[model samples]
Target chain A: MATEHAHVEEHTHPGPRQYVIIGAILAVITLIEFGVFYLEMDAALMTWIILVLSSSKFLLVVGYFMHLKFDDVRFSGLFFAPFVIMVSIGVVLMALFFNLTR
Target chain B: MQYLSGIDDHRTSTGLDNRKMLMWAFLGSDVMFFGTLIGTHLIYRNRSLSGPQEEILSIPITTISTFVLLMSSLAMVLALAAIQRGNMGSFRFWTAIVCVFGSIFIGFQMFEFAEFAHLGLTPRTNLFGSTFLVMTGFHGTHVAVGILWLWTILFASYKGKIHQGNSLQVEIAGLYWHFVDIVWIVIFGVVYLIGAYGAEGRALEEVHHAARAAGIG
Candidate 1:
């Protein structure tokens, strides 16, 4: 048990400074999202841009804040498998339901 | 033994804390659950042929709420860090702030829901109302549960039940709180932002093509 814990602690977690930096980045991305929301561009283009930006926020939170980036790889495998599967399912559902076209 | 670290001292076959592993697995399954709900909302988004559609959504207010939730995640991590460092004072302060922030986000949702209701939109109003209310309503419920969970942890710390020696408690709560925040990230972008775009008569040509393909246009 001691050895296991030592291994877990071997990965250096982010300090408060890193967390504050991450929070600021998240806020900035959100502000950009707000700005992008009003941009007079193609709806599809804005959607993709927002999706990319939001995905970045999601990854940052999961990686740094949640400590997944520094934690055991097994945890990442467990979370990402279902996450990928569900995202794929969402896309397929959208395609089928919307009959998506160019 | 480094008991002060947040990692549990328990031995597991997977060499990871069982409780944390269980939480991750549960979160993975939750991803599918919410995926279905969000997908439902998107599928039915443009199908509402009634008044009080997505255009009635107040993006500015929702944006403020999103920012609050995001900050709460920050506070949650800070709380976890404090507990790990045996800084009980800082832990309690950050934890309390997290609860407050979570409550504010819920308050925003309640206001938004009431405003939508006043505008003649309810679950029974149209497909949009049903899917939108159900999706975001569930997300709001999760946030409420997270608030309650953090409050319980705060109260427990007062009882000496939580400390650096057992900071795993705070870590678990932080995990749940962060999950809730991430879910909102997806909701804010996909549902509110994109849905609003579609509702403003600026929907993608594919939307019209889809509508025509289905003979709804």
Candidate 2:
């Protein structure tokens, strides 16, 4: 990417071709996730596989298509910090609710 | 440069870009809303006394909707591509199509939820129903809001206000659209697939009981 950045074109950027590439990769990951589900794998393994594949697609869309990776780490931290906190609160809520009747 | 770039590059929005900023703020709040709903749905998943629940979630059907949404994201990118290429015709066409597909997904969701309600469960029914509806409903509202925004942008395109200068605004909106797609992917896996996992557990239990009855492997 740094190498590509060095040869930047001036006067009206042609837009990144990476969008098409990312779309293809996302499709492949989706296919793999579906295949894993119908296979003879255990539930735990299947869950992990789906989670990993989904996260990969998520990051690719965010980092590349959103231009978050190139723009600023501050932007990444700004969005992701809140995202993590929200998920944590969710986990705590789930635990509390589950333990209520236990 | 050898390329004759049709799109303008020096153009930008004023004052931190209101459209982009608004989208970010809304998504931040939406993440919390959905997180809470999904958490509860998962927590009380086993609390259903007579569950006509996620076990009823059909992947092939949901998968088709998911596929539609994924394709919408693709069209969103293509719209951005069209704008960059200075093809307003293509851009408008694609954006309109994206809106159409988004609306279709939401329509299917309405049907699915209606079916869920017809099964004698709803948001006011119980813990399970409340969480299930809220979690999926929150996502549904986002899709509705997106379609509304697409209509506004489509009009803006006709008025010439949404030119290449403010393409960043559209890009930010696309990011939100894609994030919704990603969330649906997780929901399909966790809420639907793992929900199906519960059914798989029941099937396994039935097989075990049958084996014991037959005294066979």
Candidate 3:
């Protein structure tokens, strides 16, 4: 176990510089998301755009800043498995509520 | 660099450090927790029976707050990198900045909540008010907790407890902080932008009705 842990630690993680670049990209995406609110597009199109932009920001943060991209794949599974399930439940609930309300 | 001193101490059966795995497990569960709250808010959106609607939501203010939170995530990752590299000074510096940015985000939330209350939109006022308050209130609680967690880690580092040899301590905290930031990203998109847009449309309809009844349309 000790040798295995040492082997894992031997791998290099990104330095401060790369972290800054990732942060810059995240900040740009966030600004674009805010800008979407002001665009005079179709409401459905605007919603899709916002979802795409925000989800992009979400993936960047999770993959880079959280170090999941470099870490063991198990870590990603640990976090995202429940995320997928939760999102499914949320969508189903939203559908039910929309139908009932209508 | 003394990297081997405390590095191999706590390997679990899965070859991952126990602390990191625990944090991921906790975050996985938190996904469900926040998912439910945000889903409830979305389901109840625009069910308000009276005034003080979503128009009271200032996107400019929330935009600033959202940016602040995003920058805090940057500070969090930098702090983790500093600790891993055994740079205590830089770690403390970045962690302090993270705490400050977290506090600023919370300050924006407090001001927004108070503004809503002043506009007569309390939890008891309407569906929008209730769900909005509960959802954002819980998120604010998470931010407040993160602030306290960062401070605790800062204090521990000062006491010579957290160093590069045990960078996992800082890594766990960073995971929690980053999770909180991502959750806010979802809330900003779903609750603030989409929910508020719906309320704005309803508020416009109300204005139109008032104008028509007054023969001013």
Regions of candidate 1 where Cα sits further than 4 Å from its true position: A1-11, A100-102, B1-9, B202-217
Task: Report lDDT (CA) for all predictions.
Answer: 0.88, 0.71, 0.86
Candidate 2 i-RMS? 5.0
Q: List the residue pairs that clash in candidate 1.
A: none
DockQ of each: 0.65, 0.33, 0.69
Least lDDT summed over 10 consecutive residues: which range in candidate 3 chain B?
Answer: B1-10
| Best candidate, TM-score | 3
Chain B TM-score, candidate 1? 0.89
In the range A20-95, model 1's lDDT, one tens digit per residue, is: 9999999999999999998888888999999999999999999999999999899999899999999998888888
- Which parts of model 2 have CA positions greater than 4 angstroms off? A1-17, A95-101, B1-22, B198-200, B203-217
Which is the winner by DockQ between candidate 2 and candidate 3? 3
The candidate that wins on lDDT is 1
Candidate 2: docking tier: acceptable
**Residue-level lDDT tens digits of model 3 in B12-87:** 6776788889899999999999999998888877776685877899998999999999999999989988886678
Candidate that would win on DockQ:
3
Model 2, residue A64: distance off in Å is 2.6
lDDT of 2 by residue, B1-217 (tens): 2121212222135313345555666667667767777777888886766545555566667767876887788788788877765788988988998899999999889988888878777887777787778888888888888888888988998998887655665777787887788678778777876677647567566668879999995
Docking class of 3: medium
